[model samples]
Target: MTAEKALLGCMMKENHLIGDTIIKAGHLADPRHQALFKQMRDRHQQGGTIDLVTLSTTVDLEPFGGISYLHDLQSFANVEKFAEYEELVLEKWKEREKRNILTVAKEEDWEIQKVIHALDQINEAKIDDHIAISTGLADLYEAPWQEENQIKGISTGMLRLDQMTNGFQDGELTVVAARPSMGKTDVMLHFAKQAGWNGDLPIIFSLEMPNKSLIQRLVASTGAINRLKLRNPYQHLTEAQKEQWPELIGRVSETNIQIFDGAGQTVAQMRAKVRKLMHEYPDKKPLVLIDYLTLIRPEHHYGGNAHMQVTEISKQLKGMAKEMNCPVLLLAQLNRAVEQRQNKRPMMSDIRESGSVEQDADVMIFLYRDAYYDQDADPKHLELIISKNRNGPIGTVFANYNQFTGGIRDAHD
Candidate 1:
């Protein structure tokens, strides 16, 4: 209340302060203050004096105990600390806005993304937009010595991969790309399962596959059951495998994972789902997985051009990762041109639809299984090429992939 009064006083005292302070009608919490500031703003904009006499004639000051309240507001004004008072008023306004947003969110009419975006806009007034470089020097100097700061990320559960990439860091958009039938889904699911098993919440948006098929794969991988047998459980499973059903169910039930099997979902829908989940489980850290990016349909039609649509989606996903403070592991496909090349390994240029997919991803991983092309090649051998890692070294981690069991093991293992 005092800060609100002080802000109003500053506006009335020196009309020029209005532009300098950047105060708005919403910033003043008190209705009386808001009315007074509005009048002052109007007067200043119209080249009129914003003194008490002019304000008294223009606004209805009767409800605020007549002109005496305005006098008290003037007494509270301190020009030297005007900025500090403005900051306090803005902070209080933000808190009120947050409560209002949450209240509106409780109503069924409001979409979760709308509420989230509203909250984001309200908190966008950053206090430290400008800072001295020396202030960050200490943190940078100490970062190497601090173990916690060294790897500020969650584990993907692949040892060699984790060692090479330091897990998927927060605020990063990672793209895992592969040619068709090269085990991209299997490898990605394996990483998701690892993170889920470790209690890191994994939210999967499987645009291509249904939830049942995904669950069957999870059951096969976690329980070491054959994928085909797991698919036809009651009939195809052996007597021994049938006995492992309870444990397989238990293994799946214990993971902190949620799968959304929505085909052709737009970026907006995916963000809304993520925001909904985050609001529901506020405590857990979320890892968003979008299986094969190009399959996702754009919310707004981009003139029937697939490349433009995919590019927008990729950019939005990257921004969402930063805004949501989560790691987004998006699966993508290499262009069919990779298949024509003698070496089937994918390059950064091979990311389908748009080069922006590669440009936006903080880490770009390509899954290559030689056996997919060469029938006689070792089926178990796989390579995870970290072609572009913005925060770490780019390299390849060799691993063994069991096609039937859908299990991945480090090469040394």
Candidate 2:
């Protein structure tokens, strides 16, 4: 209340301050303050005087302790600390809002996701809605230029793709879509491996595969071991491979890759988990990966509307990426329409329920392996068709892909 009184008093003393203030009537807890602030704002908007004399005539000050209360408020005014007072009022309002949200959530039996979402919305509201163009220009001018061959964003480990994209940027949503057997999981793992190797945290939300299976695949990819052999090591391993197993396991374990293999994860749940990891590892850059978008459980109210569910999920995922300041690599399935085409390469339209996904993504990469459809084509050749690159060129980046180990490398050519 002191802060509210101080802020309001300062604004009343200097009518121009009311126009400059970010605080709204809702931010003030006192009913009298709220009423006074609203009137002051309305008067200011109407180009009317906002002095005590004018306000006394327009507002019923009798219920608010009359003119004496306004005089007392003036005594609390300190224009030098007006900004500080504003901050205090905002902080108190946030606290009150959080308490109210929690009370409502408990009474309504709301899901944990809904509770977190509400809290996040409050946090989002605090961000500045507008800024000077010079502020952006200053940031660009002050930023150091990227050194030759240096990736500006998180590296995907594919040199060509890195060159094209400068790697996946922070606060960006990169959608990796493909038909089954086109190696969507494999490509996602490749990115995770690269991020982990670069000393960044790679967080995988694997709704399709178990954590153990992902670990095995990661180990196999890193070790250059056949993934099939890992299924039954005793029968498939050679004497030399057996001797190297411990070292292989230790090397793969060194990468700080955290995998959550829960099925039917909501975006809110994934966001909460990512935020926790970020807090835990503040020094490391985070790269969030979700395998297969359709597997994500949408909000209950969306019901059986697949399109609306996908739209909401895509929108939230993009928002989460920006909020967390990380790159989100969401793997999505391409509809069977690509199979119907003469050329099997997937267009943006090939993504199942793609309207929102295509709109939200900063980069949309479609994986195409000719061998998947034509046995005669080179099995190791995989094309990463960058159908959408918001900040760069759109083209294909060829990679050497190992189906056996789920490994990806720069093409020999």
TM per candidate = 0.68, 0.69
Q: Which stretches of candidate 2 lie over 4 Å from their true place?
A: 1-128, 140-151
lDDT per residue as tens, model 2, 180-240: 9999999999999889889999999999899999999998888888999988999998999
How much is the lDDT of residue 245 in candidate 2? 89
Candidate 1 residues lying further than 4 Å off, grouped into runs, are 1-148
lDDT of 1 by residue, 1-413 (tens): 98888877866787777644546776777777767667777777788888789878877889777899889888988876676686687668878888888887887578865875576566344332475889888657876677663754778777888987888888899999888877888888887888887777889999989999998888888888779886567889888877878887998888767999978887656766776677567777889999978888864454687876786788778877876789999998888988788877889888878647878989999999888888999999999999999988888899988999888778973
Among these predictions, the greatest lDDT belongs to 2
- The clash count of every prediction, one per candidate, is 0, 0
TM-score result, candidate 1: 0.68
